[model samples]
Target: MYVAVKGGEAAIDNAHRLLADRRRGDRDVPALGLDQIVEQLALAVDRVMAEGSLYDRELAALAIRQARGDMIEAIFLVRAYRTTLPRFGYARPADTGAMLIERRVSATYKDLPGGQLLGPTFDYTHRLLDPQLAGDAPVAAPATREADTRAMPRVSEILTREGLIEGDGALPDDREPGDITREAPEFPMERDLRLQSLARGDEGFLLALAYSTQRGYARSHPFVGEIRIGELDIELDVPELPFPVPLGRIRVTECQMVNQFQGSAKAPPQFTRGYGLVFGQSERKAMAMALCDRALRAGEFGEDVTAPAQDEEFVIAHADNVQATGFVEHLKLPHYVDFQAELDLVRRMRAEAEAHTATPVKVAGKAAE
Candidate 1:
């Protein structure tokens, strides 16, 4: 039996060459530009940024191109690059309440303070692919309307007016964000840590967990109180500078989920909140994150934590797609020593069983004689 391993430096080199060729595709065809990926495939870029935990669209676009549009791989590339970046002083968290919203909508309210700006969305479009887009087609005249530049108010504020929503009552100045990347997610994580993890967590994984909660695994009746996709300023207060320096605007998606809760002896019943804010305009990811966030807070509301999403430890541990992928794919690598040990144990067990059976048969035959 000849099973020769073909992996070596030469094979690896060849593989890389082939990958480069494949990525570029046909030479006659126009190669994808980084700018094109960032502008045209904006949603894909958004996913990479959100999951990569990096805000730079240019870097994310480059990663996507290098990864051959494999989003998970692109995320891995970005996260790896992020580790090499020097840490400047942390900027104050962008205020979402004062965000220059591009798209703002609410499922809980018919009309919000800032009228809903439908912005660029696929929600109303038919799913069928237009043949005209096969080649570059001239862009049609865009529909024009008076831009709704109104400063949007958070929907939770309306509910809060009547004491219908639950909030920590702490002012914004009283809080600080914890970095999940710097520290391991120990049990009983702070709300900041939880949000940090969920924001960068695998979108599909979060979506499934959220779906589970909706299907009665951990029933938290959630309504999209408000979903706003916008750009917010990142400001750093440099000691040398007279005022905070503007670090430019970042596109982000923020979701606030209003869930039904009942009062226990400790507190009065009010609508509880689950929130999600991601690095890019990813409404689906944000919404799913919000749902899962509420599920993880089951214990806070005195609810039983039976579902997978409700268990904070489990969710956080498996939320990182990069980590999960590494753990799973590593099984395909050389496990020769581990498998050999298992094979030896199994062979010994089978021999012992066979001998025991023969001895029993021999003893029975002798007794009959």
Candidate 2:
């Protein structure tokens, strides 16, 4: 039986007040604005939005501020707020093939159509901390060239045409993909649901699992077929409108990892693919997600599912940081009654053992007799 404990109300209120005070350190200093976070700390905001499963930049920035720069806490705030909002109809599938390309690169090809545009990447930057950034420094404008309006084709398509890569099979009956937000996920999930889960899954968890795969824990001999970061327009099908209504564009990152697969009896020897798509320019998360996605598909390809990443139930169950945090953090709550029961049982066992030991001096069968 559970017993409720009281009398911490005043303490709880005081603790909340202390938290507020701590959150606003140095009142003399100017407060941080939401615009500054949205523009300068863009990546952190992006992560909060992606993991929180909300796309509003302003809301994400506000959450970040409210959480005192705690990313996970900010994500929790965003998610909590998101649940209160009503759901609208799903948007049409985004066509990455026509993405307004910003940063596009391919490891497999030396140079592909729409030559590698290294747009605002830190790939070549030295990791040294610059002192200039500490103080007010004048930022120079980046040089730009005429926009490349040429069609940027996906790298996988080239391989697919030559029968060198596995093709993405058409959806059965062209059914709408499942929404995990609306329903609980089941084990042995379809790729669509799995991708949806991975898209919003904890980046660090996915990164570690992906790293494990690279270290021979379910290696697929993967290559970066393509990684693209850009903006894409979203369209929603309105029942009344004759045509799909256009929603505002959103920035996203897409990764396609090509893995070597020796042909099975049912299929020819060709390259397989793992896909990842995420909100904002989250290259690392997207890439890691793709690796994990490929690892999770081991069962489909008749490969042994021995690794943690290969276990669908394990990955899916532990992917949500919000849920994981809730389960873990809930331990901090009062468990007085439950703990008291355990304590009583332990003490009873100890007392019984002590009594038995003290009484044993009489000896079995009465040695004195």
Candidate 3:
């Protein structure tokens, strides 16, 4: 029953102009710069980039500005922009083991190789807001430390060495990991594709799902094995080059969760793993994604799938915020025809019911008379 209604071109144009005017704000105040957004509102930019599945800081910052700081809107813009870019080639898998570590820590271990470096985190900070931040205040420089050049071993590797945790199986040399961007997602997806979806999934949605597990909805009794944030070199193998060449470095956050599993007939008792990796310093998103990732692997480990997070079809289909928002927001568009049809049907049914009520019911003998 959808009907086209066209005559709002002028109104649409005026609305767009109003949006631009509102985005600019007060004339007396200076317009916000992209550089300021990149450096000052870095976490917001990072979130937009991570969810948008794009790595360009400049573009993400610009999207944030254009969206008037609406994160979902900003993400949509970046994702839309990403579709137009040409694909040169896929980069080699990032080797996080050799990453220039910024912040690395483990709740399971107090002392590990490359002892916990709490770099630029709000973990210990009080939640109270400072009035000084609202005004121009002199800022102090961050403390410096000697760079640790040694390769920091992954915490999961330690558990794997002791046979306490299951190993991440290596993929076949001939096979490349599935890319969700290039193809439609099918149910019962492989771990690689699932990971890719979770990496870019809505943070709040994943967070709620992760929280549900802790409350005994498909409980896994998980522990944060390690969380690391740092920069890693991205290399691309080109036909013209003899070997993979370094493209540049990008910051990322990786989280590993260890969940205990009981022994089944096919396997012995061991600790299972959930992994999350996302662009920029998104520790919360990484941790939540890891929890959901493990929950979704219930089938692989002979566990009952009893939760929303464990449902492959449900999680995969609804993870993308852009898709979710688009569908949800489309309801605001023209539904006049559809509503009119429904209204007419309801009115007709009501009138028929009223008419039938008004008609007197007669007894069998009296009706003939």
RMSD of 1: 5.0
Model 1 off-target regions past 4 Å?
1-7, 168-176, 359-369
Which TM-score value belongs to model 1? 0.92
lDDT of 3 at 29: 93
Give per-residue lDDT, candidate 2, residue 317.
92
Model 3 lDDT vs. the true structure?
0.91
Higher-scoring candidate on lDDT, 2 or 3: 3
Query: Which is the winner by lDDT between candidate 1 and candidate 3?
Result: 3
Tens digit per residue, CA lDDT, model 1, 225-277: 99999989999988899999999999899999999966768777899989989
Candidate 3 on 226-340: residue-level lDDT in tens?
A: 9999999999999998999999999999999999865768778889899999999989999999999999998987788888888988888998999999999999998888899
Q: C-alpha displacement of 70 in model 1, angstroms?
A: 0.8
Ranking by TM-score: 2, 3, 1
Q: Sort by lDDT, best first: what order? A: 3, 2, 1
Q: Cα lDDT of all candidates, in order? A: 0.88, 0.90, 0.91
TM-score of each: 0.92, 0.94, 0.94
**Under the 3 Å rule for N, CA and C atoms, how many clashes does model 2 have?**
0
